[model samples]
Target: MRWFWKWYLWSEDWKVEGSFPYHLKKMVIIVAPHTHWKDFILGVAVRSAYRFTYVKFLGKQELFKPPFGFIFRWLGGTPVDRRNNNNLVEAVVQKFNDSESLVIALSPEGTRKKVEKLRTGFYHIARQAGVPIMMVGFDFKNHKVIFDEPFMTTENEAADFERITNFYRPIEGKIPEQGLMHF
Candidate 1:
């Protein structure tokens, strides 16, 4: 496992920014500018390089079918019923409470399609769980993965979001767009 991670997983140009603090036992990690399906592949490479062991993420419940579902579960995926009106943040918080070291990664962009605003679920989940947010960025310019300063949400949600978004702003050109631009 470590052999593949050290050699084949990460690209030579890859770099990480902020350190994953030891104090943070449970938290939310957000992957941004989710413009392509390829981002998912890059995520695995990044995780393997960092030797990140505490990652788990959500996918649509439909993906929880047959052989692929088993593979997804083994790879740390949780099935989410997107139609449910119940707050996902509360559910994520409960998961944090249940595990000693839970690290959930979410794409703020939510979909491959472009959007005017990033989803706020990552913030809400971290805030509710009383854990810091680890902001990870994949810059296509040099094909590098940058890890920003992991932060804990305070009273100001808007400001905190801006701070997080600013890091990705410079490399926003790498963001791919779907045909539907008006939305």
Candidate 2:
């Protein structure tokens, strides 16, 4: 699988940027500009290429149903019921506390459609779990999977979001119209 991903990434001309922080025992990774489903496949290839078996990703409850659910689970995906009134952050935080070493990657945009601003769940989850936040950008325009250095959350959320925005601003998603438009 790792060799396959290495070939796939090379065949697709995708370049992974930055040194992955492999030493972190736990982290909340945020992947930005998720404007298409292909991002998930790209993520899988990259994960395999990097041998990131400890990292887990969340998928909608719908994706976790039927015969396909098992496949997702096998790929380290957890079913997330993102419906109203669910204490999702608390639940995710608990997963961190329960695990000795875990890395959960979440999409800050939370949807495939265009969003005015990022959803704050990823930030709050990292803050509450006492884990560092690692930002990853899928730059479709440049065909790059860029990883940022992990940093712990701070008290000022607005500032943190500003920093996140700046990091993803230049990266184009699969569907440029549905992703965060650059200012």
Candidate 3:
């Protein structure tokens, strides 16, 4: 069942650089142009393929329900009650500190819709954790998954997002709804 889903849902086009560097033992991965929900499956599939067994990610607290919650939790979903406290950065940083080799995955878009300003949580988390930030490109344009160079947040949201977006400019197949948020 897992193999079937992976074959159908995940991208067939992939380019790996190398094993997650040992120096980057602890890091945050930023997934950009998060214009569609399908990226979740692709992300999980890639993680499994690379044997990246331990990953942590944020999701709305509401999604943590019953059977679905069990599956999500098994796959590293950490529920966040953003409405009560919007300080996900601090919470995620704490999680990093709790784990030996944690890798938190974040979607800068923050949703499956267009947004003018990218969320800055990933930047702050990476900085607070004192770890490198790696880029995971969904490559909707070319139907691929790419692992690019790692970076460290410079606390410059606008410029940093631009640099990250440009790195994915070559990718195609971005959904039309993502147009408004295009860089």
Candidate 4:
């Protein structure tokens, strides 16, 4: 599978930047410019190419049902009930605390549509879990997946967000118009 994705990415003219930080056991991976469904495919392919089997991603609970449920699970999908007041951050923090090694990826935009601002859940989760946040840019225009260095959160949210915004602002998504255009 890893070789297949390596070949596929090359065949598709896509490039992955930055190496995986294998030293870290637990961290939140924040993927930006998630403006199309194909982003998931690219993410999975990159994960395979890197042989990063510890990675997991949250998805709506509905996606965990029916014919494709097993496939999602096999691809490292963890079902999340977004509708419930589940104290998701705390739950994830507990998961981090209990596990010796885990890496979960999340999209700050939380959707493929254009948003006024990003959802700060990933940051909060990283802060609460006492883990660093790794930023990954899915730049469709450049055909590159750029990974930034792992960042530890400070007391100031605005400053942190400003830094994140600046890092992701230049990356264009598959649907360019729906990409992160603002902080």
For each of the candidates, the C-alpha root-mean-square deviation to the true structure, in angstroms, is 3.1, 1.0, 3.0, 1.0
Better of 1 and 4 by lDDT: 4
Residue pairs with clashing backbones, model 2: none
Give the clashing residue pairs of candidate 1, or none.
Answer: none
| All candidates in order of TM-score, best leading | 2, 4, 1, 3
Summing lDDT over every window of 10 consecutive residues in candidate 3, give the lowest-scoring window.
Answer: 13-22
lDDT (Cα, 0-100) at 44 in candidate 3 = 78
Mark the regions of model 1 whose C-alpha exceeds 4 Å error after superposition.
9-13, 172-175, 178-183
Q: Encode model 4's per-residue lDDT on 1-183: one tens digit a residue.
A: 899999989999998888779899999999989999999999999999888877999887888999889998988898888778788888999999999998999889888889989988889999998899999999999899998999999999899999899999999999989998655
The C-alpha stretches of model 2 lying farther than 4 A from their native spots are none
* Per-model CA lDDT versus the true structure: 0.73, 0.90, 0.71, 0.90
Clashing pairs in 3: 140-172, 141-172, 141-173
Residue lDDT tens for model 3, 88-114? 788778878888888778776677677
Task: Kindly list the per-residue Cα lDDT of model 2 for residues 7-26, writing each as its tens digit.
Answer: 99999999989978999989
Residue 154, candidate 3: C-alpha displacement in angstroms: 3.0
lDDT of 1: 0.73
